[model samples]
Target chain A: MDIIVCVKQVPDTTDVKIDPKTGTLIREGVPSIVNPDDKHAIEEALRLKEKHGGKVTVLSMGPPQAGDALREASAMGADDMILLCDRAFAGADTWATSYTLGEAAKKIGYDLIICGREAIDGDTAQIGPQMAEHLELPQITYVRKVDVDNGKIICERALEDGYERVEANLPALLTVISDVNKPRYPSVRGIVEAYQEKEITTWTAADIQADEKCIGLDGSPTSVKKSFAPEPKGEGEILEGTTNEVCKQLVAKLMDKNVVR
Target chain B: MEFALNKEQEMIRKTAREFAENEIGPIAAEIDETTEFPKDTVKKLGELGFMGMTVPKEYGGAGMDDVSYAIAVEEISRVCASHGVTMSVNNSLVCWPLQKYGTEEQKQKYLIPLANGEKLGCFGLTEPNAGTDAGSQTTVARKEGDKYIINGSKVFITNASQSQTAIIFAMTDKSKGTRGISTFVVDTDTPGFSIGTIEQKMGIRGSVQAELVFENMEIPQENLLGKEGRGFGLAMATLDGGRIGIASQALGIAQAAYEESVKYAKEREQFGKPIAKFQAIQWFIADMATEIDAARLMVYKAAFDKWQGKPYTVSAAMAKFFASDIAMNATRNAIQIHGGYGYTKEYPVERFYRDAKITEIYEGTTEVQKMVIAGNLLK
Candidate 1:
């Protein structure tokens, strides 16, 4: 089995600050880290590779700096790291990103595909299902538990209150949640090997034979008109009077506002 | 001369910091209060290839450079000095010597398990009478046909009770003084070997320190490390590397203290303003930050020298003394900056203060470090 995991490098949101005057993110000095949920995806892929003997390959699409993210996944025991880096892939929305990744997946061939439920920066949660549709493979999103045997993948997709069990055939895709598994720290040897011994394969738009019309900003349809931090909520009013009296007053106010019958 | 860490070292620092903050930080206080050994976390560290960072991979170790090892020790110590010393003793004191001097058979038998973290090891050199004057060792080993009879007691031995293997020094020829000493690897389970008294300590309590007594302990001749009468040189050489680790540990302690002081000064209020608004507190923070950075550079220089196969005895000594001094001073100021809360266990500054003291005392004292540095200059 050969598993391909898609990862992204994003600004560490914890340290990111918004400019109060301009309403734009200050990203100059912010450190970049692999998307947190994608770490779970990499960890799950490695676990699957361990239980069933196979190779685990990690792939990403971004600038050259994203190679660091791929190197990190390699340190976590991924067999190979590939970065789809090209200026032509710039300004890709979820659709263009999915198309580019799906094209690469078609070239690499995979027994299974794994992706995070969503990237923290974008929070679109569309890439995995979109890629699945492009590749015409079955996909299970919000997967919390997975079992594989006899070319069939069984997964527990987390729901609002519970989880739903779903099974799919081979050549499937999974978008894992943070609860899927805890990621392991890279061993000292792993870090050394990742940097010294392994080479990250870089593919461009032409290498994956991506469609020129669907590979960059030209293919992306969504556009942001405005972005700003949400307004801070105001303090709530405290009800006055005795318990019964306050309750009656609350009910009357709620009724008057059509908040209650 | 590059000031920045390379990609590999940066990754090591990141991994260690994450591990320290997420896995060890929550339990640090609990372990200190209980004085119980942190066995589970130590085992986890072993799984991460931290127990023997510089040992070769073929020998079941991580095979990392000395700089990477230093960064790891610093990160771990930043959160818990007890774990820091545990890792330091295993890597610098035990596995290092075994890898450098042990014969293939010895490496096969002992080094493999110790390096792999399947077993733990401790160094046994400090004695009741021998502290800084390590040449005053009194333990005796007498040849008895195919075996040697050992008798003596060691004090302040780290990981004494829990260690599966011990690299001990004993007087094989009393007339030769320090030259008579020989190094031997002894299984802690030998018939006459026993843990005597566990010490109650003021700092790094989460790591055990105890007395070891060897009463008529018998061992085969094959356990000897290097050649007879060469133990003193081997021990001294080992301490040179060990000092680098201690220096990194001290740097970590000081860094933690400085960070705490900065955080506390900004939030603590007095006289209608945050204490950070005061010039006096600002000076302390500035001095701490400056010294901590200096100590880190010294440690890195020592580690880099060792990695490059350059002579590093003086550099290591200089780093150890300077870094440890900063650790002590920084932690003291950290407590002062926190006012009454710093002196109490409500904050970790008090714990850092206690842990900082041991860095100056262990491996070699500050005075001994200066002696090594000055002695080289005079010569």
Candidate 2:
């Protein structure tokens, strides 16, 4: 029942400010936080480990500062952590990121690998499925609930409308949605233990024996030419009046616009 | 030397703040109006490891340093002062002293559940006769062959009625005066122990204070805490550390009021513009901001001194006295900033006003704090 969770550290979207002139985010003052949905993935993995007797390991591929996310994961009851940080891992797209993660995953007894369905910053939703492809294991996406039995995993996956149930055998991957479980805050005791006791192992490119040609910016095929905030739109009308008057006005306006007959 | 909190401390503060805002903030006003105890929230606080933030992990506590405890208290108090006091009395006055002085057997029986927040506990020091002068005790405990009979009553005891455990002090030998006091770990369910009455308080209504009566209450000799005659020192030691918690709590109340005041002042207009345009309003806001920052620094300093094993009695007293005073002033100003609306229950400033006064009076009074500070200076 050994489980591995892949987490990422991203700029706190709430605090981010964009430079209108440069059409880029001002990263200097903004704080870095654990990717929001990734916490749910960690929670799901921990819950699974709790029910079935096993250890939970959190692995992350980012800059050295990503240790903050790994440390946070540890505080949330991760059994151990590995920070896949290296200069060579810079400028990675989702494809290269998953390949590096797959290399690290090979070293562990990964009965199940869990990840957030999508990173909010990139919103690619590709890393989970890509890692699964690299590992040659079945992968479940948008998982909201998980139930495990003897070498069998049942995942209730969320879809565009309603949801669907999917099952996979041992050595599978799951990409969880934020709706999966309410992530628990790191307990005070857990925080102290994480800081005072746990050791977070840091791995470089050579440590994981990743192929030079298939790692870092060299391997990333995707490139962004420009980024900018969309132009603001005018505030929408409230259509405020008496309930009957507002409804009548709304209907007249919609009919005038040919929206409703 | 560093003003910044460590990473772990920040994490604890963030967790407490998030819990307070998301879970406690919505119901805080309602709880104040009804004076209903938030038992479920308190239990959640315990499960979150906030009830015993500074206790060591071995004793089923958070194992955080005193500074972290201060941050936790301040953050919790910022939202609901009721929860603040409940957590404060548990961590500072009960679990702390229990960890320090309790025998291994006592720690095992009482400290485990208390530190883990599985059970709630209270300190029974203030009584009918004893308030400012804690040495004067009317409660008597006469030793029997294998047990002691406790008689008399405790008043204004936080969590008295609801707590499962209590660390009570009583006169073991009347002739020895203050030295006669002995501390005992009393289980609230023991026969002859009763909750007399719940006090109708002006503020912090969520966590009510109650009277505890001990009539012919019997307990085993093993329940004795520290030494028989050394209870005064133990009690004072506990109260000294307790000051840091209360100070932090006061800082939280003041911080909350200050924030509310700014928000109100910004949107509230009097003469064609926001009231914030007036120098009078701006000055009050400025003073509150400055005082809160100073009080916060003092609290962290006291907590840091305690963590470093320095003699922090004077600093703790200073922090308690100054912070509580600021809490009272800031809440009053918050109400003033809101004008007529502040006096009404429609806003939370009125509740903050009521909660602020208690901080200056509890744990140790402002006068008591001054005396402690003066006494230390004269020494």
Candidate 3:
């Protein structure tokens, strides 16, 4: 099966810094990493490619620097990569970003689409399902396992209370969580081959036939008004006891506070 | 003049860092405490092309440059110095010389497997009496038709018992002194070959040292490495590259120590304030960061020079000497920074402290490195 995995490069939240003056992130010195959940998505894609003998292509819509993420995907065993980079795509929120990727996807449609459940930066968890809607395909969210046999695709999706198995025809999109699988590090040979031979096809907005009205900040409906760290909550009590004792005391305290049973 | 690592080098660094963090970090302390070699992870490292990173792709290697090898060593050593040395020895000592001097058949037979990390190998140059003065080796080899009867014992050899093959150095003509030395690719399972004592070490305990005794051990003449008299020069040249690996290892240890101290000073409190606020602690941190930066530049310079086929002996020695000194200094201060916590095994810094000492002593001692540098300078 031909697979297209969408990925993004985000600033490492572990070392994030904020600009107090502008109420925005200070990204000058921050390290950029492939989105964590997207790494799992790639792992799943690679695993699928390994199993049924198919091609895996990674697609991304971001700045030119996002090619780093694409190269990383290739090193992790993607057969091809397409990077949608254009000044017209800057300052795009989820709507505009998904629209651009939707256009790119239409231009380079695949038998399957894979994405991370959510981006740590936005935490919106909307892009994957939004892109699926734009492409007019069904999506399985929070997928922990993917199985393809015959002409059908099967997924086990994680839910809050339990998990459900979902089946769909070929040409489907999946948004996976971290529980899917651990990503493998690229081998030294893989890194060398990726840089030496792989070409990261850069697609401008016009190349993907993206609508000017549906890209960049000009296309987004929502706008951020302010940004700041949330107020620090006071520390809660640390309950230390045996497992059974801790469970009894935790239940008793919750009952006393009327928080839960 | 460029300071930034290229994209490929950066990726290798990131890959090594992630692998070291995920696979080696958790078990590093446990292995050090138990003195158990992480055979599984080490073999995986080989499969990942770290064993013979500098060797060409045709030779079953990752086809990376010396610079990448240096980066890999530094990253692995950051979490586990024992794994670092194991990789360094395979890349620098065993695979390196064989690639440079071995014949086509020899390359196919030995270098391929060694580079592939399919088999472990050791360099048997340092004996009981031939530590600093390697030319004074007491081992002897007598040629008999197609075989050489070797007789001697090599002590303080790293990966001795674990290695399946060894580059054994012995005297072919005792009258020629240094020129008498001959190197052979001897299988450790040779009939008369026996593994003797295992050393109880201070640091890098996971990668143990052992003694190999050869009593009339028969090695085929085709197993000879390079020319008979040229063995010493090959060994010396191999060490020139080996020192870069050692320097990178030391840099990793120092970096680990430095990072631990910074984390400690920030969280550790005194007088109801973080200890990092104190000028004494700040000064130590500053010194450590600056020294690490300088040492890294030196190490990278040597690695680059080696890749470019330039003269890098003095630079390697300088890097090795300086980096190992900084390692000892930084680990000592890291323990000082943690006060009591760093002294205990609970913190990884104690193991880092133990691992740092070996970098100065192995490959070449600090004094040997200085002599090499001074000797080059005199010319």
lDDT per residue as tens, model 3, A1-261: 888899999999989877766657788889888999999999999999898888988999888888999889888888888999889898899999998898898888688999999988889999999999989898999999889989799999999998999999978999999999999888888788788878999999889888899999999988888777675589998889899999999999999999995
TM-scores, each model vs. reference: 0.96, 0.97, 0.94
Model 3: which residue pairs collide? Answer: none
Task: Kindly indicate the candidate among 1 and 2 with the higher lDDT.
Answer: 1
Better-scoring candidate (DockQ), 1 or 3: 1
Per-residue lDDT, model 1, residue B286, is 93
Model 3: per-residue Cα lDDT at residue A257: 92
Query: How well docked is model 2, in DockQ terms?
Result: 0.83
Candidate 3 global lDDT: 0.91
> Candidate 2 — which residues are off by over 4 angstroms?
A236-246, A252-261
Q: What is the Å distance of residue B188 in model 1 from its true position?
A: 1.2
**Weakest ten-residue segment in model 3 chain B by summed lDDT:** B156-165
Q: Per-residue lDDT tens digits of candidate 2, residues B185-299?
A: 9999999889998999989999979998999999999999999988999999999999999999999999999999999999998989999999999999999999999999999
- Segments in model 1 whose C-alpha atoms lie over 4 Å from true places: A232-261
Q: DockQ each candidate and list the results.
A: 0.80, 0.83, 0.76
